[model samples]
Target: MGPRNMAQGSSQKPEFFVNPEFITTKTRAIADRKRENTPVPRFTALVPRGHTVPVLNKNTLVESPDGSYRDGPSTHGTDRFERRRADIVAAAIPVLNDQGFKGMRLTAVAELIGLRATGVTYYFPRKEELAVACIESGFAVLDGLVAEAEREPDAGARITQLIALFTARDAAVRQGEAVPLASFSAIRSLEGEHRDRAVEGYKAMFRRVRALLESPELAAMDQTDRTIRAIILLEQLFWAASWLCDFDIEDYPRLAARMADIVLNGVAPGAIADPIPSLTAPARPLASRDESKESFLKAATRQINEHGYRGASVDRISASLNLTKGAFYHHNEAKDDLVAACFRRSFTIMRETQIEARALAAPEACRLAATVEALIRFQLGPEGPLLRTSVLSSMPVEHKTEILGHSYRISRQFASMVVDAITDGSARAVDPMVAGAMVHAAINIAADARPLAMAQAPDIVARFVRPIFAGFLAA
Candidate 1:
C-alpha cells in the first residue's frame, strides 16, 4: 500500500523502534517525504512505563492505545531543545539588563518567547540558573572579543581594537542582529556557588584584559598601573552601553575612534609636564546636618552596591549599622526611601566637589584634575563611596528617571570643564560630551578601588587618573 493509504487504511499496528538512532533516521525520512506530498508513516517508540514519550514533532507523532506517542531521544530533538533554550536566554538578557536580577521575572521572559513558565523551567529549573546562563553568555562573548584583540602587535593597538570590536558588537545588538549583552551590575545579587562562579569569571576576564597592557613599551607600568588601567578600561566599556544609545548606529565607528583616542591620548594638549596634579590634602567630608542619618545612608549605599536592591534588605542594612529594624524605620520610611536619600547624598557630593573645583585658582585642566582627585578620594574615604549608577537598574521607573536626570546634569558639569579647558588650549580638542562621560565613568568606578590599601590613593590617581587625562600611553 502507498504511504498515504497505509496511514489512512491500515488496521494493523505499526512497528515500534526501541533504538534512538533508528528512530532518528526513520523520523527524518518521514519528515523529508512529507514535504514531497507523501504521508508520514505511523510509528511507535518503546519507552519505559511512566517515562515521557519522546517526540520527533508534536504533529507527526501517532498515539497508541495507551495514549503514548512513539519517539526516542535523537540528535535532532536535542538540537531543537538547545535552540529553544538559547531563544529563552536571548529573551532574558534585555530583561536582566533593564530590570536587574532582582526585577527579572521568569514568566516575563517566557512570555517574550511565547512560551509558558513551565517551558523555561524545563531547561533552567530555577531563575538563578537562568540568570547564571545569561551572565556566562556575556562572559563568553567578551572573552571572544578579547581573544581577537590579543592578535594585535601592541598594547595600544589591542586596546583600540577591543574598543572598536565592542562598539561593533553593541551596534549589532542595537540592530537586533544579536543578543543584548548582560550587565554585570547585579552579579553581586547572585548567591552561593553562582556568585562565586560569576566573580571568578569576572576576575578571569579582568586578568586577560590586563594582559593587553603588558607589551615592552609599557614595561614601566607596574602591576598596580596595569591593574588600575584595566579597571578603568573595563568600566568605561561597561558604561558605554548606557550612553551609546544616544547616538545613531551609523556613528558607532566614529564614536569608537573618538573613545579610543580618549583612552590612548587623553584630553590634554601636547604632553603636559604633570598630567595629573597632586592633591595637597585629602578631600574634606561633605557637610551633613544629621551625622547619624548620614551614617545610615552610607551603610545602605554600601550594602546596595554590594548586594543589589533585593539582596540589600532592611535587616541587612540595619545589621550593618548595628541598629535594629525599628531604628531603620524610624529614620527611613522604606528601603526605597533610603535608596533615594543615598542617591541624593551622592549627587550632593558630586555637585559640591564640582563647585569647589570650579572655584580653584588654577587652570581649567588643573581644576578638572582637582575635581576628579577629590571625587576619587571621597570614594575611598571614610563616610564615602558615592552610590554606583548601576543601582538605577533595580529602582522603580520614576526613581530611575529622576536619578538619571541628576546624573546627566553632573556629567554636563564635567563637560563644561572640558569645554573651558579646550577653550583655554590646555586640553586636546575632543568630543566634550564623550570626554565628560568618560570622566563620570572614571569617578563612578573609583569606588571599585576601595579594596586597595588606603595608602595607594596617590598611586591610584597617578596610574588611573593621569592615564585618563593624559591618555593611557602617556609618559
Candidate 2:
C-alpha cells in the first residue's frame, strides 16, 4: 500500500450495489476475464523493470555454506536470503495488516514497491508461493525475538519475552477488522501444508513458553498444563486485539495478572487465592426498585455481547444494573423486543453507512472501493464487537430469524460492490456474488479473532482484504 502505491491511487477503481432483501440467485457472476496469464506481482516496489529471475522461496530450501544453519537457525533462509526475505515482508505485511492478505494481490505489492507483477513472480511464482513467503517472513521476525531470549541466561527474562510476543502483533489493533480479517480465512478453513504448519507452529510456541518458565522453584509444575494455560490467555488477547481493536492491558489488568498468578502459582485449590466473592443478593423486579431504562439496556447490551443472550439471563442483566423486572419491562414488551431494538439499531447503521459510501464515490472502482473500505473499517472498528453481538446467538427461532434477516439486509447491500467490480472485469477470479460472500467470510473471521492474538494486525487485515478485492478489482 505504501512505496510507489498504485493500489491506493488518488483515482478510484469501480462500484456495484447489492439489494438489501432476498438473495435472488444460488450463484451470481461478478466479473469474467480471458484466461491469459499475466505477470505476477514481484516484491520489488517502486523500482523500474529489470532482467531479474525468481529465486529461493517456499518449496526451495536456502542452504548455508556449512550445510547446517546458524546456531539457532529457523527452518528457512540463509543470511543473504534472510535479509532479502525480511525486505519482502517489510514491504508486504502491510498488505495483510491493511487490506488483508485475501484482498491484497502481489500486483499491488509490486506497485507499492514500484515493480511489475512479473517481477513479484520473480521473487515467488504462485500467489500461494508468495503467501508462504509472507508467512515465513512473519515467523522469522518472531524467531529473532526468541533468539534474543536464548541470548539471555536468566529464565525470567526469557519468559517475559515469550509472554510479550503473545500480546505483540504487527501493530496495535487500530482498525476494527484490522487485526484478524486477513488471517481468519486460513484459521477458519485450514487445509493442506499451511494447516499442518499452523498447528505445529502453535505447539512450538507453547513449548518455547514452557521451556522459559522452567525454574528450580517451578519444578513441581507441569509444563504441558502451563503451556495450555498460556495458549488460552493468548486466545483471549486475540479476542481483544481483533474485536476491541485497541484496549491496553490495563483495561483488564486483573486478567493478565490473574493468568500470571495462575501460571506461576499452581491452581491446586489449596495453593490458589480465593476468587473475588460472589454476591448472595436476591433478585427483584425493576418496577419494585429504581434504575434508569438506559442503564438497564446498557447493562443488558454488555452482558449479551460478552456472555451471550442465552448465557446472559434477564435476571442477571437486570441485577447487573441493580434494577427490578417491572422497571426493566416498563420500556419494552419483551426480551425479543429489546433484541429487535438492538438488531434494528445495528442494521440501520450498517445500511446507512453502505448508502453513504455509495453516495460519496463515483461509477467504477472509487464507488466500489468506498463501499468496501467503509465495510472494512466498520467490521474491524468499533462496530466489530457489536456486530458480532447483534447476531441472535442461542435465541428462539423467530428471534434468530429476525436477527438473521437484519444481517441479510446488511450482507445484501454489500453484494452491490461485487457487482461493480465484476462489471468492469477489474480483478482476477472476480465473481461479484462469490466475492461478496468471501467478504462476509472475511468479516466473520475478523469477528472471531481476539485482541491479543496475531489477528490484531493492520498489516494482516490489509493482506487479507486487499487480496480479496484484488481478486475482484477489474484490471
Q: Which candidate is the best by TM-score?
A: 1
lDDT of candidate 1 over 1-475, digit per residue (tens)? 0011112122332221122211121121121222222223322121111111111222222222331222222323454565455556666777887788878999888777667899889977988878876776566566656655666779998898788877766665554334566788768899997787677767877888899999999888778778878888999898998889999987787888899999999887342355444443334555655888888888999998889877899999999989999998998888888899899889988888788777767778788888887778778767678899988887888788889999999999999999999998878899999999999998899888887674365555555667878788865
| Candidate 2 wrong stretches, greater than 4 Å | 1-86, 150-155, 161-190, 232-475
Model 1: colliding residue pairs: 45-70, 266-471
After TM-score superposition, the amount by which residue 281's alpha carbon in candidate 1 deviates from its true location, in angstroms, is 12
Assess candidate 1 and give its TM-score to the true structure.
Answer: 0.81
List TM-score per model, in order. 0.81, 0.36
**Residue 116 lDDT, candidate 2, scale 0-100:** 74
Quantify all predictions' global Cα lDDT against the true fold. Answer: 0.71, 0.40
User: After superposition on all CA atoms, how large is the RMSD of candidate 1?
Assistant: 14.5
Residue-level lDDT for 161 in candidate 2: 36
